[model samples]
Target: MFFADGLNCSNFDRAVFQELVDGGLGCVTVCLGFWEDAVASMDALGRFRDLVRANKDLVAIARTGAEIEAIAGSGRCALVIGYQNTAVLNGNIRFPELFADMGLRVLQLTYNNQNEFGGSCYEPQDSGISRFGREMIPELNRCGILIDLSHVGERTSLDVVELSEHPVAITHANPATLVPHLRNKSDTLIRALAARRGVIGLATYANICGEYGASPSKWADMVAWTVDLAGIGHVAIGTDHGRNVGMPDLTWMRQGNWSRIINYGAGNAARPGKVAEPGWIDTMKSFGAIATALAARGFSQDETALLMGGNWLRLYTEVFGETDAQKQLAA
Candidate 1:
């Protein structure tokens, strides 16, 4: 789904998403923060709360599978709140339940750089989760919110997988196909996550592939590698699609930050092995591109479904604890 951000230029309005749903999307894991303070996030949350209330038919905050199904039954899509960073919490743990009530079901502890929670993948020191980070996990579990370790440090993520009572998700990431880079998880970490019943959202980002972003087919190759290592149930789709039409000057800011800068200014803007000819697109289109490539490589329908969205849906359902009523209805 189109994850519209602050730079959305247009209203961070419901209309943008209405357009995408009209265009055809199953569910959207919408963002509430990229880089903002507590008050700013609270403001955004209020706006979103109002938006959901105003357009109940068009948007409903679905924290679990049943809600998604209910929304889907009416021919609309589900909106799940996701925080790219823990900045809103801003070291205060009280916000979890507040945000959860505000429809925030997913949150990543850190963004590109380190915060109070722990070191970022981009940081020189790869220390794991801090005291506050460890302190937050049980609270997150208590509130029934899912943890997303996508951009967190290697140590921090492993620490979370071990500590979180609920299944954690690397909301948007890729398995090593094994070159070690900051963006992708190592095979060992993926196994640890899967063993703990956590979900891995295999990203189609160019950086995740390696120094060179691999081809679209290479993304499928990573999924295949991950499924082989952790099994299909642990794999899922998180397109990390940036509705670039709206949002910040990420390209410029990211250039100087966590990412190791490359020839971003020139035509070679892709992560590395990716299709440099054309750069970043939505994860679904990226998957569609992967499908054709995988077909040539003979990937079957079962595998394709797991890699696309099935595994992600299954994980979300299982981790969030669906009710018996939710089950009887979906059944």
Candidate 2:
């Protein structure tokens, strides 16, 4: 059975590559930078590209759904490059096509803090998408880059959902109804997302999953609930579990030269080096256990398979199938 993880921010090293290969994960949306500026973002992505090139046998950069499907069961995992924030774009309306051409298929409109795009979930005032952001949407759609609204403010997220011509995604967020975290989505948003035929990859981050965190059963049940709430084809796994393997770097992830005051996000003042995840669903390899849990939760085999990876594959194909000519013309 082919499994897909919505996101993996692990080190681009042989060990992590081997783990994905061993885990039987077909694809992962990789983080190039959390909050990098334009030139720095390009440089970081260049380095990641080098890593992929260096380990061609273990992973291949997948630009289209066909590429991801072709690489399935080929003893290697496909890397779907993405950005966690739009700071890298530096408010440039033209760069969406440029980055899309570079094979970065996913771009988040905002991170935990506001930029030119609009407000963040962490902001006091949730301003909706800015005028510049409104302008960028058409270009992003024209470029066939999938829009991710994971860390965006509630209003901005809704604005994007209404404005985007193509379906958008919340690639690594959970339902706030369950966890009540700032980063999680509301029931209204989830229902709207599904109505648009978009996908939401439920995140397995400790805080977002809940205080007790995610065991295989807990994880499965959360997914089952989301499936019931959003429909089966709209729920998938995006275990935001990358900080587990290496030295934790909240400073870079949270501050990132954006603020003078330390923003220890998620209200953890201690800023623990590593946030613990439940053992059963902690790593990439454990993703398949979700399938078992889904089946046990009374999901049919077909529904379980769709939740595992088929839904992600379907979304990927719909958004990335556009040809260069089509994108250019759409521009």
Candidate 3:
């Protein structure tokens, strides 16, 4: 369901994703690109599109809660297209809508370094949204594209939260109450984002979770921090699990400015003590158990459901909900 690299729906191993879905992963915000070119990303999406057409019985793209609801009820998981970087847009405004049409519902503006849109969390400047980012906001708004600031710079995250006409999303991030990782959104930033009524997906990427993001509870600690700071409504589970392998897009970032010394996608393999550590979910743990733990963390059932998936669905309906054009398009 997390449309990872290589094994896009084209080379999709349904068995892997299906286990998650069958185990109750209602909707999966799948990744499509990290540092790919416009053509390559589009080619990747097109392949997914073809797969959707070929496998309508199992998977379907959903832009609305109704579709997601249908997918979940049918005992299949909903696929929400996502991108980890804007590089695939290739510095063009139109790509937001074009990719939106291709079903790219969620997008993180930058991966690790500066791009035309904004400074990366790893970039020296970290000033905020660039001219290209300013350009990207309105059009992404117009196209009903949900903005994700997960891997973007702190300043840029604040700016987009303020600049966007609709709520934005930090699809996968740690709350960052402690030291900042290139991908963790700080409490201040998370609160600022929460003020805009956005959705913040708690990721299971080991590097970002502390214990080098390798421990599931390290992930839980981040979520607990977000819950402490942003509250359950602003917190949600989002294991940034890619696939059998991490995306080459991350490899592509190394050619630019990778701060961490190891592979971002390795999860916990490279981290020395993580595997030996107790209860490090690595996000590979049964997602349902993750949900149960979140509930036990004092998250009320309503808020628990929201953080689990409802908030994301509501945020989607709010932004991509019923624009006059989208209404017509849906019609």
How many residue pairs clash per model? Answer: 11, 0, 7
Error of 2 at 178 (Å): 0.9
For candidate 3, lDDT tens digit of each residue in 1-331?
A: 2111101211255565565555566677777766778998988888877876676666677876667777778776677887778888888777787777767777777876777778777667787888877878999888877888877888988999999999888876776656456567777888888888887877655556666354444455556767777766666666666445534444454443434465443233455222221244422336665566656666667766776677777777777765345679888
lDDT of 1 by residue, 1-331 (tens): 2121111112335666675456444566766776677888889888888887888777677778667766766767577777777877867889887776666778888877788888777778878988998889998887767888877888988898999888888877776556566767888788999998887876544444563344665655666677889987787666555443321344432443435655232114443222222253342223345455545556677766555556666666776665435558989
Error of 2 at 38 (Å): 2.0
How many angstroms is residue 31 displaced in model 2 relative to the true structure, after the best TM-score fit? 0.3
Residue 81 lDDT (model 3):
83
- The TM-score that candidate 1 achieves is 0.78
Best by TM-score: 2
- Tell me the whole-model lDDT of each prediction, alpha carbons only: 0.66, 0.83, 0.67
Candidate 2, clashing residue pairs? Answer: none
Q: Each candidate: RMSD to true structure?
A: 5.8, 2.4, 4.7
Top model number, lDDT: 2
lDDT, candidate 2, 84-152, per-residue tens: 998878777888878888888988998988888788999989899999989998888888788998888
What is the Cα-based lDDT of residue 185 in candidate 2? 94
| Candidate 3: regions farther than 4 A off | 1-12, 211-221, 246-250, 256-285, 322-326, 329-331
